[model samples]
Target: MHKRLSELAFGESGTVRYILASRHELNCLGVRVGKHLTMITRQPIKGPVVVAVDGMEVAMGLETAGCVSVEVD
Candidate 1:
């Protein structure tokens, strides 16, 4: 199913479908379409969301995560 990156549960993984914003910035962080991503951690109270992409962990804010679209695996 397609969902926002921020909606992914802890330990869940997915393939990135598309990004709604910050394309350049996110790409620099190794987040791009077709990349496999695993939700490593999600901080509470609207905190950052940490995801593993291509063996590297990247931390992004909740708002940014909300703009990332992914296909659950």
Candidate 2:
């Protein structure tokens, strides 16, 4: 199933399908389409969401995470 990255539960993993905004910035952070990502951490109260991509972990704001579409494994 495809869902917003921010909607992923902890430890859930998926491949990126698309991004609704900040493509350039997200790409620079290794979050481009087709990349596999795992939800590492999601802070409470509208905090940032951390995702693991490649061998690195990238944290993005909730709004940004909500813009990322991922195909769940």
- Candidate lDDT scores, in order, read 0.97, 0.96
lDDT of model number 2? 0.96
Error of 2 at 36 (Å): 0.3
Q: Predicted candidate 1: what Cα RMSD to the true structure?
A: 0.5
* Per-residue C-alpha lDDT of model 2 across residues 12-63, encoded as one tens digit per residue: 9999999998899899999999999999999999999999999899999999
The candidate maximizing lDDT is 1
Candidate 2 TM-score to native = 0.98
Model 2 Cα shift for residue 46 (angstroms): 0.3
Q: Give all TM-scores, in the order shown.
A: 0.98, 0.98
Candidate 1 CA-lDDT value = 0.97
Query: What lDDT is reached at residue 73 by model 1?
Result: 99
What ranges in model 1 sit over 4 Å off?
Answer: none
